[model samples]
Target: MKHIDVKEIISSKEFIGQEITICGWVRTSRNSKSVAFVEVNDGTSLKNVQVVVEKGESDYKEPRVGMALKVTGTVVEGRNNTVEINAVPEGITVLGDAPTDYPLQKKGHTLEFLRTIPHLRGRTNTFNAVWRVRSVLAAAIHEYFQTHNYVYVNTPLITGSDCEGAGEMFQVTTIGYSNDYKNEEDYYTNDFFGRKAGLSVSGQLEGEMAATAMGKIYTFGPSFRAENSNTPKHLAEFWHVEPEVAFAELNDVIEIAEDMLKHVIRTLLDKCPDEVAFFDAHFEKGLRARLEELISHDFGRVTYTEAIELLKNSGENFVYPVEWGCDLQTEHERYLSEKVFKKAVFVTDYPKEIKSFYMKQNPDGKTVAAVDLLVPGVGEIIGGSEREADYDKLIAAMNERNMNLDLYSDYLDLRKFGTVPHGGFGLGFERLIMYTTGMANIRDVILFPRTVGSIR
Candidate 1:
């Protein structure tokens, strides 16, 4: 009577004996003189439903793998009450045909090869599981924040100020090619918006603005970077989850981040058992055990100075030299989490010169109140710090760096009017997905990855 999906029929036991219309792409089919068996998947889950069709019972267009079909059938029960459909040949319709040259058939494909066909990769079982898990992960993030009374803030994409102050931003311009820029600095002053603007590298600054007013706010949106890195972990564009909390210090934000991560991992285990199991078997062995271990114990916390000492004392030779003021490389981060802590660890109190200007300077005057969360497999999953609340101190820090004064007047106004001790951390959405799914490359988790010299 009504159209239903393959998942519904497979899940609902009462659907047996009812007449239903099912539409999906054929995964595999076998034809015979008396009967034809077809496996169909509707992208609802990792599993597929089986359909039985008798020859000459009605109009039966021979089905092929990758072909779209509409089949009217009566539900039947197979062994162990497995729900199946018996197609009425007269009601069958071949919606779309796939040629023999179909790129994807019933075979294994390398992840490298799949990247070339981004549009059609979803048809594969691996990608189907990846995207479905990604959907659930995103919902988990929103659910975790919303239930915690954090207001959702939509930060602007085009920003005039560089939040990280590293200047890795994609410029937005409307100047026509007909007019050559005699002065690069003068071009932006005369272009659209009447000033320089670029895609935001981080929504932390804007999120902080909302947090000062809303008390607790989170921003989940797309962020861009102009860095030309070709590493497997880097992306030109990615999704970021940032939560800013007013009246919260560095330790406060660290607690929130740990709780949020555990909550999402627990939710994923509860919701997507099959998808998680699939990845555990294929991508990462002992994946569930790793996440369970993470939630069961408290994450180890240590100072950046302490981490450097441990690394330096170790006998292993590192490619990059480790010093007190130097940044921690990915290899060093992984070593701390995997070998030293054997779980997720939070390294705190980084050198002030290496951190951003917004981070609050510590009483020691050498380091800032910044923390980086590193996991066993992934190097650095999050970076956050307690913001500098004093107006005079912020101005001094900015002036020391010779930052553009005109671009951050509004930001400074926030501190001038009403400022509170606030702190926040940013989580790369793709990196989390990769860690959860045991996906090695960052590009595999993203649907259409944008990296150095690659747009399509």
Candidate 2:
């Protein structure tokens, strides 16, 4: 049995009249007086290969719409299509019988319903597009780094420090529940290690070391956040693309991040035109045009001070009133990106009070050289700032924030070891995918979105 993948059939025109064996899951079935047609897919591509089944007192029964089958048939051109592999199947063997309760059916189903069955959602066209586009984006990220002489590094997922300083963390525990519970007073700890351990929030701290030594390095992996926000953007566990560069300031980091995004957008638009067309028509009405505009236009750069001033002057009703001391809300971010900038913009130099401790303090003693890259539809796709290279100031800031400086001793030593002014920002991978694919929710972009209520 010679097997040719359906995807190969896309370019292999000579196999039209040849007998070939195709093994795939049945997508849909249609029966006529003397023949039945079944559309099948083998994860080769989105388009299902059509199989013709004729009832000629043949022993092999027609396969079900969701059943797995191996069919030996001859390809022939059929009606209303080109490259038709019309098959009068000589043998049809069932590989796996699907239960009637299979969530994915021929009939159209809602994305909300598909969320309940993450195991089978990839069979749908939308998810296939989303997942494939995500893969393409990841590849583009790696390619962009390689071209720029940035070394790819994998950082550990389990750690003892919180990079963001946000009070959201999930503990990394052992399989055993052997914790000494004395009146539930002590924190849970397994006998595996004496001290408490938890999942890493961001891989930035580790990547910083690699970058310090290697000059340029990027950490791309899963980052866990126990944030309970039920918004479309928040996810419990998501992927982060953090690139740390030595001797680079906030402005350079912002430029690199912007360039990286434009690179990815252009790559996706060029590499996956069919998928882009699909998304542009359905999810993002003018996605292709928006991406083209981004690649060509210079991003708007404004200080956080300026962004706040714009918000104040816009006369827009913001639920969270914008002020220098307060953090920017999603609404405020959207207003700036969507209305004020009208394109991807960088809001830089935020108040030190609202930012992380390690951010480099400006000469004014108020704002740090932090910048967030915000796009038209999505707000705050990237957040980064220059590091405080002054040892005294770094230690003082950490102490002021009441953080355990002892844990960040290595990080402090970088400043002590004659460190230059450096900066890096984290690009949320799912969020980036949302921006590129015109996906509205972060949930749909991720394969199995770990949210507040979902671990499945």
Candidate 3:
């Protein structure tokens, strides 16, 4: 009687005896003298249903690809439920007209070729699955946090601070301003906040302050990394879901990260079994198995010292050469997850120099309580650590890293107040999508990946 979504139609077994109205994008079309058949996808189902369109004297041309339209037809199952529309359409309403030269055609397109058309890539099957899975994964994250009683906190983006403070910050600025210059005072005074400010690398710092007082908190939003890595894995701007929890130690944080990852994945697998099956068929052979393994098994965790020893004994020729103090590269991370562990692995107790200042200093004086979660295909999906709760220890560590303590007075104030041992991890949202879908490139997973060379 009334218009229905194509998704609803695909799910309907009750509409067999009646006519119905459906709306969706035109996937494909075939025209005949008296009849036309169309494959329509409403973004409700992975498969498009075939709609039989009989030509009328009104001269209504067949819908083109990328065009949005509404079709009213009778549902008669002569062939299958998918081919129930045997009669001529009563009417068609065009919501939007797509130009003839629309980018997404019915032809096969390579993933590399699609990067250039990122703005419209979501219309593709691969991207649709990726983005849909991505959206679900993010919701799963929020659901996990909220269920765990973690407050959703929005940290200031334009604040005069960079959490990592590694000098890889992109200075927020405005043109045509008097304070915009490389002169003596404007660098700090004339910026967007009337002081130097850049995008946050990790929300952990602010998240920490919130967790200390609020018990548990997480900030899920865009974070910027200025590292000039041009690989398919790295992006300048990406989304990160960082969770900080008070009264949680390094081991506790490690377990929390693993559990959170497994929870999101299991939720997706349960809810989107069809999409998971799509991934299992088209994306990777071990897609289902990999998801199962992550949920079924405990993540392998080895300290930095033990990992280095394992790396040396791993007998595999490493390009960067494994050392005790050096940071682990992506290759090494992959080796641990793909080869040694055969699942997600947490490499912890990284050298103090290689990690952020917040990680608790181990008694060894060489390593901090930092852990990185490495999945089978994606190198590093998460990075987190236990914070140094001792006020003197935090101040000493900050000074050792040459970080300004003044800018971090509020962060340190968490320690000044009643400080309990706390820690958390940041899950890279894009990398998680890459890990889940078996998509190789970070750019392919993100809607529009921001890389070193390409801004648009």
- Winning model by TM-score: 1
Pick the winner on lDDT between candidates 1 and 2: 1
TM-score of each: 0.96, 0.93, 0.94
After TM-score superposition, the amount by which residue 414's alpha carbon in candidate 1 deviates from its true location, in angstroms, is 2.1
Tens digits of per-residue lDDT, candidate 2, 1-456, equal 467787776546677778778888988878877888888887766677887777776654666667988878777765556455555546677889987777776567877888888888888778878888989999999999999999999998988788877768887756445445653225444334544567889888888888889999998999998887888888988999999999998879988988898898899988888788888988889998988988898899999888888999998989888777789987888898889878888999999988988889999998888988888777788999888889999888888889987778888888767688778989999988888888888888888888887788
Ranking by lDDT: 1, 2, 3
- Model 1 alpha-carbon drift over 4 Å, by segment: 56-59, 176-181
Worst 10 residues of 2 by lDDT: 183-192
Residue-wise C-alpha lDDT for candidate 3, range 1-456, written one tens digit per residue: 367766666666677767778777888888888888787777766767678877767575878888887777777665553445544655667888999899886668888888888887777777778877988999999999999999999986655666876777666766445544678466556555666667777777888888877999999999888898898888999998989899999888988898888899999998777778888888798798888987898888888888889899999998999988888888899998889889888888889988888789999898888988888777788888888999999889888878877788888888877989999988888888888888878888888889998977
lDDT of 2 at 200: 89
lDDT of 1 by residue, 259-362 (tens): 99999999999998989999999999999888889889899999999999999998769999998999999999999999999989999999988999899989
Spell out the clash pairs found in candidate 3: none
Clashing pairs counted in every model = 4, 1, 0
Cα lDDT for residue 312, model 1?
96
Error of 3 at 175 (Å): 4.5
